[model samples]
Target: MAGSFFRVACQDCENEQVVFGKAASEVNCAVCGTTIARPTGGDAEFTGSVVETVEAR
Candidate 1:
């Protein structure tokens, strides 16, 4: 198996992110600088909405 990718969102900042490879202690919101929790995985792919609406990419 490759790995699982997790989609993270900051409720306050409305910043969405994709995290992989290593789990992080604090994920900063690029737009608003809010910290989020990142999970563990690696080499993941993005989808339509997750890339469009959420992730900003």
Candidate 2:
């Protein structure tokens, strides 16, 4: 499956981020150090609000 990018907002700091859909490592918020996404074998499991999806055209 083709991977995409997701625009997410941190739950604690409200910081916006662009994370990999299938991130192989933990993704944290730059502003608050909050755990935003975690590796789940395939795609990254997000713990923040999904602001939008970014796909390559």
Candidate 3:
């Protein structure tokens, strides 16, 4: 799949942030310092709530 952006909300703190779909590293929540997403071979594995997907323009 092509790389995109995702809006994820932290389940612990309800903090929202945008992350790369194909992130090469682990993504954490900025407010609560919780693990939000993990990098895989393709799309990032999300541990938080997926709010929406951002379309590339």
Candidate 4:
């Protein structure tokens, strides 16, 4: 199984960003610098709303 990517909308600034499902580090919003995703042991925990799941090609 391969890791997936997601389009997340930031709650604070509404910045849309693509994040890795199995991110090894914390992901922050580009516009507002807010914490968007946190790295868990396996998958990342998204703090913002998930707009869509990006298909890996």
TM-score to true structure, per model: 0.46, 0.91, 0.88, 0.92
Candidate 2 global lDDT: 0.92
What lDDT tens digits, residue by residue, belong to model 2 across residues 3-35? 999999999989999998999999999998999
Tens digits of lDDT, candidate 3, 3-42: 7888999999999999998888999999989999998878
Clashes of 1: 1
How high is the CA lDDT of each candidate model?
A: 0.48, 0.92, 0.90, 0.93
Off by over 4 Å in 2: none
Residue 13 of model 1: what lDDT? 59
Regarding TM-score, does 2 or 4 come out ahead? Answer: 4
lDDT of 4 at 56: 62
Residue 49 in candidate 3, Cα distance off native in Å = 0.9
